[model samples]
Structure formats: C-alpha cells, structure tokens
Target: MKLLMTTAVSALVVLGSTAAMADIKLGASLSASGPAAFLGDPEAKTIEMMVDQINEAGGINGEKIDLVLYDDGGDPNKARTFATRLVEDDEVVAIIGGSTTGTTMSILSVAEDAEVPFISLAGAIQIIDPVRRWVFKTPHTDRMACEKIFSDMQQKGITKIGMISGTDGFGASMQAQCKDVAPKYAIEILADETYGPQDADMTPQLTKIRNTDGVQAILNPGFGQGPAIVTRNKAQLGIDLPLYESHGVASDGFIKLAGAAAAEGVRLPGTALLVAAILPDSDPQKPVVTAYKAAYEAKYGETVSTFGGYAHDAVDLMTNAMKTGGSDPAAIRDALEATQGYVGTTGIYSFSPEDHLGLDLSAFKMLEIRDGGWTLID
Candidate 1:
C-alpha cells in the first residue's frame, strides 16, 4: 500500500513538471528557397531571432515559445500542405508567415477552416480583405503600396507611366491595384507589358516602353528576380525614364542582382526599417527600428530587409496577444484584433475588426537606390 502511494506521488510530480514546462507552439511557413527566397530567407531568420530573444528574456508568462517553421520554396502547394500539418498535426496555437502573396493566399482556406489565427507576412491585400474571421497580415497591402507610389508621382507632376508586371500572382494583383488607383491619382498608364517570372531578359518589354508615347516613368510590379531583370534590362536599353518598382522588391538582394548601374536611380515605396538610421529623432518608430537593425545585423551579420521585419512584427503580435489571451486559438484571434498602437520594425500597427492591416499610406517611405544603397527621397 505504501509503495502504491509513493508511485502515485511520483506520477503527480512528473505531471506537474510536464505542465509547468509546457511551451507555446507557433507555426510558420516561409519560402526559404526557390524564387521568393529573398522574401522568405530574411523572414525565417527574423522569426528565429525573435523567438530566441523572447526565450532568453524568460519568455511570455513563463512559457517559452517553440516555433515550427517550414520552407515552402515559394510554392503554393507546399504552403498549403504544411499549413494543413501545422493546424492538424503540430497544433500550433497561433500561426505566422506564408512568405509571399501567392503562398499566403494558398493557405488562407487551411487557416480559416481550422479556426486558427493566421498572421501572414505577405504584402497582398486579399489575405485580409473581406476579413476572413481568423486572418490578419503584417505588411502594407498592394493597394496601399499603389496609393503611396501614385501619390508620390502626383507630387512630382509625373502624369504618365509605363507598366510591366510578371505573370506571378503577386505581379498580377499589383498590376490590377495600380491600374485601378492610377486614375484616382490623375496618372495614366501608357504602356502595359507582361513577362513570365522565369524569363531571363526583359529588354523587349523595356524597348516597348521606351518607344511608347508620353511615358514619363516605368512602374514594374513583381517580386524576386523578375523586377531585378526589368531594372537591368531597362538600364541596358538606356530607357531614361524614371523607374518605379513595387514594394515587392524591397530587398538588397534585388539591388545586388540588378547591379549598381542598373539599380541606381530606382525608386520604391518601403517601410522605414530600410532607412531606420536616417529617421529623425522625433519619429516614434526610430527607437524600435534602430534596435531591430542593431540586433539583426549583429546576429546575422547582414543587412536587414523590410521583408524580415514582417516576421518580426508577427512575433510581436503573437507575443502581445498571448500576454492577454493565454495561447488559446480563439482568444489569440480576439486579442490580435484588439491590437492597437503597437510599434515595430514595419510601422505602427493598430488592427480593427474592419481593417486587418493596420498600416496607412504614411507607413511607406519613398526610397531610392543610389551608390548601391537605399536612400530616403525626402
């Protein structure tokens, strides 16, 4: 009888320890390989960095976070499959990442059906638009990006432009958004061109644009190497028109791939993280942005990308929600929706029931590449 009682006591202690040591599971899907590697690679590193920091800081409510990350290789099918596994098998409380717009869109149904709170790092509006009850996104939307660029164009009195976009889902979506919003800015699109994501050269498209009438600027909306291709070809073709790239190519990788001469004088809308050091002292975001840059650079020994900060914001959002929500999927969703005035590397985030992406047009800084670095176009 005494042995039986002792056994029960030992079992109780084991159970207690197990319960005390329980960790918060967060799942992520990033395209660490393939076409969108520039986006996903930084994102994956940022997520891991934030996770390590949080854990080192004694974690949230004494529960350390365990991130289950998968590389989707920029493939929609892989994103879908892993998203299913995250919800059904790993059973993460809240999920983050889907490296690009196309990959993120692929997992929306999986997250929605599973009733998990999904925070995508992609830069498309559709992920959160129409407000899927469980969906939220971290970056400025394609629509917001378009408005930011168009507003800048109006300020410069650039009334006409050429447009080239890849056939990828991200490119197509931005193409539609830019076209829809251009008229509102009183800027007319003069030439519309399309190219495949894998197409090696874009000289033909730039040639067509250079010959188009009244094309004051070139707006190319695409991600990965595609925009770099356009930039390189445009310079080679001696297309003297101002080149405006989408926020999709907001990484140093694009600049490196395109080379200094080709990428020089290129402009794009970006989160202030790219120019964190240049931000004025009074800017509210300077503190966090600078800290992130220092920490990221120290750890990775490479430049920080705005794409990385998308995942950083995701970690902050998840940890914030968990502070009040207690790791329950439903509670996290409610807490996430209630997020307000939380500043991170991307911008100030204040999510509401109607708007999942909290950033406005002000979140984008007009950035130009000069001397192989990003320069703030003040």
Candidate 2:
C-alpha cells in the first residue's frame, strides 16, 4: 500500500509540472522551402527573433513561450499535417502562421475542430470567411489591396489597365479582387493573362498586352521571380507602359532581377512596414517598425520584406494574447479578436466581429522604386 501511494504521489507531481509548463505553446506552419521559400524564410527568422524578445522580457504571465515551427514547403497537405501535429502531439496552446492563403485554409478545419487559435500570414479575404471562431490574420486582404490600389490609380488618372497574374493562391486572390472591383473604379481591364508559378518566360503574355488598346497601365500581381520576368520581358519587348505591381512584387530581389532599367517607373502598394522610413513620427507603428528594422538588419544584415513584417506581426500579436490570457485557447482567441489599436511591424491592427482584415486603405501607401530605392508617391 505504501509503495502504491508513493507512485501515485510521483505521478501527481509529473502532471502538475506538465500543467505548469503549459503556459503558452505556440505553433507555426510556414513555407520554408519550394518556390515560396523567400516569403517564409524571413517569417521563420522573425518568429525566432520575436520568441527571443518575448522570453527575455519576462515572458507572458511569468511563463516562457515555446514556439514550435514546421516548414510546409508551400504544400497544403504538409500544412494540414504540421498543424495537426502541433495541436495533437505537441499540445500547443495556440497556433500561428500558414504563410500563404491555401496553406492556411488547408488547416482551418483542423484548427476549428481542435479549438486552437489560428493566426494566418496569408491575406485572402476568404481566409477569415465563415469566420472560424479561432482564426485571425495579420496582412491586409487582397480585396483591401485592390481597393487601395484602384483608389490611388484614380487619383493618378489611370483608367485603362492590363493585368498579368500567376495561377497561385496569392495571384488568384488579387486577380479576383481586381476583377470584382474594376467596374466601381471605372477602370477598363484590357488584357488579363495568367501564368503558371514555375513558368520561365512571360514574353508571350507581354506581347498580348502590347497589342491591346487603351492599356495605359499594367498590373502584375505575382511573386517567386514572376515580377522580374514581367519587367524584363516588358523592357525586352519595348513596352514602356506604366507598370503597377502588387505588394508581393515589392522586393529588392525583384528590382535586382528585373535590372535597374526594367524596374524603373514601377509602382505598387506597400504596407507601412516596407516603407517605415518615410512614415511620420506620430504613426503608432513607428517604434515597433523601427525596432524590427534595426533588429532584422542586425541579425540578417539584409532588408526586411512584407513577408517579414506580416510574420513579425503574426507572432507578436499571438504572443501578446497568450501572455494576457494564459494557455486558454478560447480566451486567447477572444483577446485576439478583441484586438484594437495594437501596433506592430505591419500596421495598427483593430479587429472586430464584422471586420477581420485588420487595416484599411490607410495601412497601405503608393510606392515607386526609383534609383534603387523606395520613393513614397504623394
């Protein structure tokens, strides 16, 4: 009887320790490889950095954050599996990531069934559709981006436009938004071309656009070297129409890959995090943006991208909620959904029951790449 009692006491102690250590276990699913590797690479780094920062700052509720990450390699099946493993096997208190729309959507059912709080890096409006009680987002939706872009185009008097999009989640999302809202802006879409993600040449698409009439501007929404292809092709084919790119195409690599001449006079909508240098001092995100930029440069010795900004916001918001709400997934979700005026690297996030996109037109600004630098257009 004595031996049995002693064994039971030891088991209780083990259980108590496990419960105590469950303050906040966060999981992430990101595309750390495949064609979209660049998007998730910075995301992984930013999450690591934010984890360190949170832990060093006395953690949340006096407990440390254990961030478990998985590389989805831009595969939907891989994302679902990673999310399941994080929740069931690791017993993470909350979940973050799904760097792309499709990857995030792949794990929604798992997250909803398991009652885990999910914050996705993807900005598809459909990501938050049906409003999974556990899911939230950090990036502006493609619809929001299109609205902002079209508004800016209206300001610049760009009525007739052409579009080239890849057959990927990000591209498809933007293309749908552009098509849905074109009539409202009175913008005539002359040519809409689609390309595969792995396609090497876009010259044929540009050739089609060049033949179209009344195409004063071109909107190319894609990533993974697609922007470079479009720009280079446009220049090679001597098409000098004003080119407008999506935020996905607003990377330094695109400018480099497209060559300086090819990248000239291109415009795109970018989150404040990408052009924080030009943001006013009174901006709520100035400090966080400043700190993130400095820390990222110190660690990687490279410039930050929209991917990094969105990733940092995703981790920071989740960590803050976990800190305030303990390990209760429901409580964390409420806290995240209740988020208002919370400033992060991306922008000021204020989510409500009716709106989950976080920010509005003010969160984005028109930016042009000139002389190898970002110039905020007035």
Candidate 3:
C-alpha cells in the first residue's frame, strides 16, 4: 500500500508539472530555399530570432512559445502540405508566415478552413482584398506598389511606359494590377513583355520594349533573380529610359546580382525600413525602423531587407494579439482584427473587418538605387 501510494503521488506530480509547462504553439511555413530563397531566408531568420527574443523576455502570459517552422522551398503544394500539418497535427493556436504570394495563397485555404489566425508576409492584394475571416498580411500590396510607382512617374511627367514581367504568380498578379490601375494615374503601358522564372536572359523582351513607340520608361514587376537579370539585360542593350522595379526585388542582393553599373538609376517602392537611417528625428516610424534595422543587421550580419520587415511586423502583430487573446484561435483572430496604431518596421498597422492589410499608399517610400545603395526619393 505504501509503494502504490508513492507511485500515485509521483504520477500526479509529473502531470501537474506538465500542465504548468504547457506551451503556446505557433506555426510557420516559408520558402527558405530554392528560387525565392532571398525573400524567405531573411523572413525565416527574423521569425526564429523574434520567437527566441519573446521566449527570453518571459514569453506571453508566462507560457513559452513552441514554434513549428517548415521550409516550403517556394512550392505551393509543399506550402499546403505544411499548413495542413500545422493545423491538424501540430494543433497550433496561430500561424505567421507564407514567404511569397503563391505560398501565402496556398496556406490561406488551410487557415480559413481550420479557422486559425494567420498573418501572411506576402505582397499581393488578392490575399486580403476579399478578406477571409482568419487571414491578414503585413506587406503593402502590389497594387499599392504600382500606384506608388505611377504617382512618382506622374510627377516626372512619364505618361507612356513598357512592362516586362515574370511568369511567376506574384509577377503575373502585379502585372495585372499595374495594367488595371495604369489609367487611374494617367499612365499608359504601351509595350508589355514577359519572361519565364528560370530564364537566364531577358534581352529579347527588353529589346522589344526599348524599340516600342512612345515608351518613356520601363517597369519590371517580378521577384527572385529575374529582375536582376532584367536590369543586366537592359544595361547590355543600353536602354537608357528610367527603370522601375516592383517592391518585389527591394533588397541589396538584387543590386549585387545586377551589378552596380547596371542597377544604378533603378527606382522602386519600398518601406521606411530601407531608409531608416536617413529618416528625420520627428518621424514616427524612424525609431521603430531604426531599432529593427540595427537588431537585424547586428544579428544576421547582412543588410536588412523589407522582406524581413514583413516578418517582424507579423510576429509583433500576432504576439500583441496573443497578449489579450491567450491561446484561443478565435479570440486571437478577434484581437488581431482589432489591432490599431501599432507601429512596426513596415508601417503603422490598423486592422478592421473590411481591411485585412492595414496599410495605405503612404506606407511605401519611393527609392532610387545609386552607387550600389538605396536612396530615398520620397
């Protein structure tokens, strides 16, 4: 009877300890390798670092976070599989990833069906335009990027332009959005061209744009190495018109890949984080962006990209929501939706029932590439 009582007491103590140490599970799916690795790699690093920081700072409500992260390798099918595993097998309370638009869309279905709070890091308007109940995103949409670019072009009196886009999901979506809204900004896309994601050369497509009638400038809407290749091809062809790229390739890697001579004079839309150092003292976002830039560069030893900023914002949004919502998925979703005036590396976020992506055109800053570095134009 004494032995049995001792065993029972030990078992009860173990159970109590297990209950006391229960973790809040969070899941993420990213393309940390393959073609889109540049975007996903930094994003994965930021998420891991942020989770570690949170746990080190006593975690949320005294519960440590159990992060379940997967590398989708830029494949949508793989993203779907991982998202399903996160929902059904891992049973995570919330998710905060999707490194690209394709992967984000793939994970969106699972998140919606499972009713899990998901904060995506992709830059596609479609991800949040229809506004699924459980889905939100951190990056400024490609449409906003388009509008921002056109707004700059209008100021420069550039009315007609040529476009060369990649065949990838993000490239195709932004291409459509740019075309659809070109008229609103009084800009006409006179020449349209395209390239495959794996194509090494884009001279032929750019040559056609260079020779097109009334083409005042060129816009390349794509991610990965395609835009860098396009920049090189344009330089080789000596196409001197102003070149505008999407926010997709807003990284120093792009400039390095394209070569300094080729990438010079290139303009694009980017977040304040890219120009954090130059921001004035009174700017509200200056402190937030500078802190993030400093921390990210210090830890990773690489120049911080806007892609990493997206991950930073997503983690912050999720963790802030978790503060009030605890471990309940529905309550977390509500808390995320109610987010307001949250300053982040990307922009000031304020979510609502109608708008899942809580950013305006003001969130984007027009940037020019000069001497192998980013220069703020606006």
| Model 3 clashing residue pairs (backbone) | none
Q: Residue 203 in candidate 3 has what lDDT?
A: 92
Weakest 10 consecutive residues of candidate 2 by summed lDDT? 15-24
Better of 1 and 2 by TM-score: 2
lDDT of 2 by residue, 1-378 (tens): 999999998986675456434457888889988767888889999899888888898888888888788899989999999999888877887888888787889988889899998888887888887666888888888877787778888988999998999888788878988899888998989899989888889999989998998888888887777878888888889997888888887767778888888888888888777777877898777888888998998998998988899988888788777767767889888888888888877678888887665777777878898987788885
Q: Runs in model 1 with CA error above 4 Å?
A: 1-21
Which numbered prediction scores highest in lDDT against the true structure?
A: 3
Candidate 2, clashing residue pairs? none
Residue-wise C-alpha lDDT for candidate 1, range 1-378, written one tens digit per residue: 999999998996675355333489899999999978878998999999999999999998899998888999999999999999788867788889888877888888999999999999887777887888999998888888889889888998999999999889789989999999888999999999999989999988889888988999999998878999999898888878889999888877888999988899999998888888778899898998899889999999999988888888889998999998988999999999999999988889999999898888778899999999989886
Ordering by lDDT: 3, 1, 2
Instruction: Name the TM-score of candidate 3.
Output: 0.90
Q: Model 2 off-target regions past 4 Å? A: 1-22
lDDT of 1 at 242: 89
Q: What is the lDDT of residue 372 in candidate 1?
A: 93
True-structure lDDT of candidate 3: 0.91
